[model samples]
Target: MTFDSLGNLYGTTYEGGGEKSEGGGTVYKLSPGSSGWTETVVDHFLPTGQYGVAPLGEVSFDPHGNLYSTTSLGALGVGTVLEISVNGQSRIFSFDRVDGAVPAAGVLVDARTKTLYGTTTGNIYNHGNVFRIAASGQETVLYDFCQQPNCTDGSAPFSGLISDEAGNLYGTTEFGGANGLGVVFEVTP
Candidate 1:
């Protein structure tokens, strides 16, 4: 889910609508209706192998009002980052997995830098990784898990991240940490 600059709410669903898995997901906008709340599915995920399936996680918006999110299992068996235009045009960020795989978190786009940050569940290691997807679609790994004892730093970020004004990222771990009770971490760019 996400909030726009004017505080409008938007979101995407992974599954469970009338169109079934073939429909993939729905991009929605939320607003206050006369009765209470109203939601509209701005776009429906097409049943195509090229487009990723089951979009998941919180959403983010670009300055132009495009929304972004990720999918886990997709037509390629990897994953994808997608942009939904305010007018409802869908565009794939389009990065192949030489860099990583199976993205499970919403993208954090640093609009000032035109760079995007995300995490992926990789093929070789289920441990997952944080990666950078450039505006030009070049992908790079920022961190990988060793999967040893304490995980030393932290492991498996299952949610979206928050960045400070200084360009530092703060997030949580779902598993594998010092006390095995999960962890909170700061990543400096």
Candidate 2:
């Protein structure tokens, strides 16, 4: 989960809500209450087909208070980037093999540029990749894992990224490296 400036925690579930459950998942908020912390569902997800299933990471936010995230497997049977506001959800990009698929982690937004960055574990090479999506919804791949012989660079990043003041991205991989133990990496745009 990720915290907003106001101290509210935002996150997603892979499945289940309550006895009122529709069996997909939910976007929720946790805030400090008089007694303790309180959790409330902002919305629920559909099981499949265009709506996205199995949310995999913390919900990200823009400066305007809108929430953003991804479904590990989306309606098209790939994955999708989602932009959620009080108004509801908007599909930012549907993951297809051609564009990258099954984003396994959360997105990092550059407030200065309003751009979105994330990683996908599914691709032609089945490694992983770092991608940038602009404010207008344009996408560009910054790096694909396992590009070198024996995958000396790395593969399958399972965490979100952190960016520096210079706008470089940093993260880690679950596997692949000279010793096959994983790697910490950086990408400069």
Predicted model with the maximum TM-score:
2
Roughly what TM-score does model 2 have, to 2 decimal places?
0.94
| Candidate 1 Cα outliers beyond 4 Å, as residue runs | 17-21, 47-49, 87-98, 147-150
Candidate 1: TM-score?
0.85
- The model with the greatest lDDT is 2
Candidate lDDT scores, in order, read: 0.71, 0.85
Minimal lDDT window, size 10, model 2: 16-25
Candidate 2 lDDT (Cα, 0 to 1): 0.85
The CA lDDT at 8 in model 2 is: 88
lDDT of 1 at 7: 55
TM-score of each: 0.85, 0.94
What's the residue-level lDDT of 154 in candidate 2?
Answer: 92
**Tell me, what's the RMSD of every candidate?**
2.4, 1.6
